[model samples]
Target: MTGLVVPAAARVLSARELRALAEVAERERLGWNANDMSLDEEVLFFLLPYSYEAQPMPLWKCRVIAVSGGLPVEIGEGKRIRFGRLDVSLTTFRRLPVASRKAERQLLHWLAWEAAVASWRSVDEDR
Candidate 1:
């Protein structure tokens, strides 16, 4: 049996956006960035906002898997790409809750932010 194939749109999260995420992470005080982390069931999954105009989405999503040398070596989703190892600044880590409901709320907020940004960009492009 052949599995159904779905065409997924590509998106990217720019360094600036990453910085924002980092700031959030840092505020949460996950650590001084890159402080070894353990892979838990709770992962930060960022959603990419759909846009008609093709602008590289800044880091589709980031997974807080591990921290090395104060750097977050986590998984990231890129536009039409899947990054196995990705890193974020201390700030991003701050926004992420190591283990709590706060983490889930933060994830939702991040997703909403991405969607809003994508929609805005698409509208701007049309103009």
Candidate 2:
């Protein structure tokens, strides 16, 4: 029997996305229980919006692995890629709550705000 293999190009959430996800976890008060079942479940819950036809397992697994290192992984190449994508995506206004669009823009904005704050705090702590 062979196990399913996901390609490297498979869409894993970038670091910024993961940080935004961590913000969702933090907002839900799940940050303190890093390795708990409830925290894992909550993370899955946030990913629900991005799911297709109720099958979010693959994407969820990828994201969970990326974020498992910590709430805010060091800002690096992945973060640069995430920000670049956001820059391109925010150039136009779009409707939301509809099946196709969902609330992706709002979610991204919120995540960006959270990531900024987290970055600032990390910098402050270094001083």
Candidate 3:
């Protein structure tokens, strides 16, 4: 009945990173299994939404490896939590990424700064 949780600091992922992870999930969905994942790979397993309240999400026999931050992580197939290859079977969802309100503000600020810089560069190039 245990569910999985991810903190924001354990890993930082973008939409593009999540999409890359989907590629691995798609492989699992296809019936091919891998033993370990690479840390350099940015994909993470998306846990089942309803299973969050469960004491422990069930574990499937098959295991896969996911690499995050340039290392390998291992995980069972049945759990609802997302994990890197190094974090397999650890049951510590606190490591997952969780952003505080302050963190969100900083993220937004950085995003705006990056956009402005990009636009300025583009304008300068045309001049």
Candidate 4:
């Protein structure tokens, strides 16, 4: 999957921005289905972009990786992994303000619905 450098200032920071960005990208990447994603993924889809604004990370240094079988983000303090600044701590990432709770909740609602639908479809496929 070719990577797109979504500029920090231009990154999806809010629910409105998330929906707008995701809708267009979803169309462009034919197989990239939000319904196939986990709740963690749905959150990270925006959080990854929000990292630039929240982590005080350099926009030029920011990058997003979109590949199947991605690993879970590490959650710990003072557990340096050699290249310290290269990684952004999600613990710190979540502390900053990004979107309104109402908007965030709504986005989550849509994701949860997607998961439910996917499960329903999967049940038939398993038969």
Candidate 5:
């Protein structure tokens, strides 16, 4: 939605989309822009989207997060990648939800505003 235009913005999001966009406006007011959050707090801020036909957050999806995730994780060969205390497989990570619908819709909306500026990150090199 940022780089490319979609054919039509649907009426279905009249409430949802407007609210989410408004929140994007309110990010600084919400302390979302605060730089003092702990590592765990940042982790919690991730994964607030997906799951009617899907998934939660930390329990199942912590791995794929390392891929395309906001933070850096040490990655190496073999099936499992060690991240902190947990070792997770590449297969498991890819299967996890980027967002979980089971989460409050408000949270899902809020997470969309993650402020990190995008830069070129090659997965092979990052890994």
Candidate 6:
């Protein structure tokens, strides 16, 4: 199935920013309908611009390759790999307890920060 990916150069948001994002996600989650595929896709789509300043990465057919250390890592050839967890469907998302959701948000933010650092290093290496 097609998936969204965060761009390599996307600025990893700071802790403060992440908190804000989580708040937004929570709000969205509150009103989300688990059975509505369109709404679910829209929520996922909403995150795209946050990570891409230039041309957005194309959606790709992808699969989760691993879930090491509680992070779901997916791969799609020729497509950017997003650091945050994007695989949680609305159905699954609604089933998660509030604490679990909070934890997930924190983990995602941390992963994004790490990805940003790695991306910066790669750019430096190219110089």
lDDT of candidate 4 at residue 5, scale 0 to 100: 43
- How far off is model 6, as Cα RMSD? 15.5
Q: Alpha-carbon error at 82 in model 4, in Å?
A: 30
Cα TM-score of candidate 5? 0.20
Global lDDT for candidate 4?
0.36
Q: TM-score winner among the candidates?
A: 4
lDDT of 1 by residue, 1-127 (tens): 7643222422233334444555654664422232333222222333222222112222223343221221222366322211232334323333433433453454445456667888999999999
Q: Is candidate 5 or candidate 6 better by TM-score?
A: 6
Task: Report lDDT (Cα) of residue 27, candidate 6.
Answer: 59
Please give the lDDT score at residue 36 for candidate 2.
32
lDDT of 2 by residue, 8-121 (tens): 222334345445555654564432222332333222112322211213111222222212332333556132111211110111102111212333343454467668988999
How well does each candidate superpose onto the true structure, as a TM-score? 0.27, 0.29, 0.31, 0.32, 0.20, 0.26
Worst 10-residue lDDT window for candidate 2 reads: 84-93
lDDT of 5 by residue, 1-112 (tens): 3442221211111223223433543552321222332233224333211211122222221211111222333465212111211222234334433443443343323334
Candidate 3 lDDT tens digits, 5-95 = 4333323344354445446446434222333333233443322112122223322222232223222324542212223221222243333
Ranking by TM-score: 4, 3, 2, 1, 6, 5
Compared with the true structure, all predictions reach lDDT values of 0.36, 0.32, 0.36, 0.36, 0.27, 0.34
Q: After superposition, how far is residue 55 of candidate 2 from its true place, in Å?
A: 16
Residue 73 accuracy (lDDT) in model 3? 26
Q: Tens digit of lDDT per residue, candidate 6, span 1-127? A: 7554533222233234334434644554422221222221112221212221121222211121111222333454121233232223333333333334544464456557667888999999999
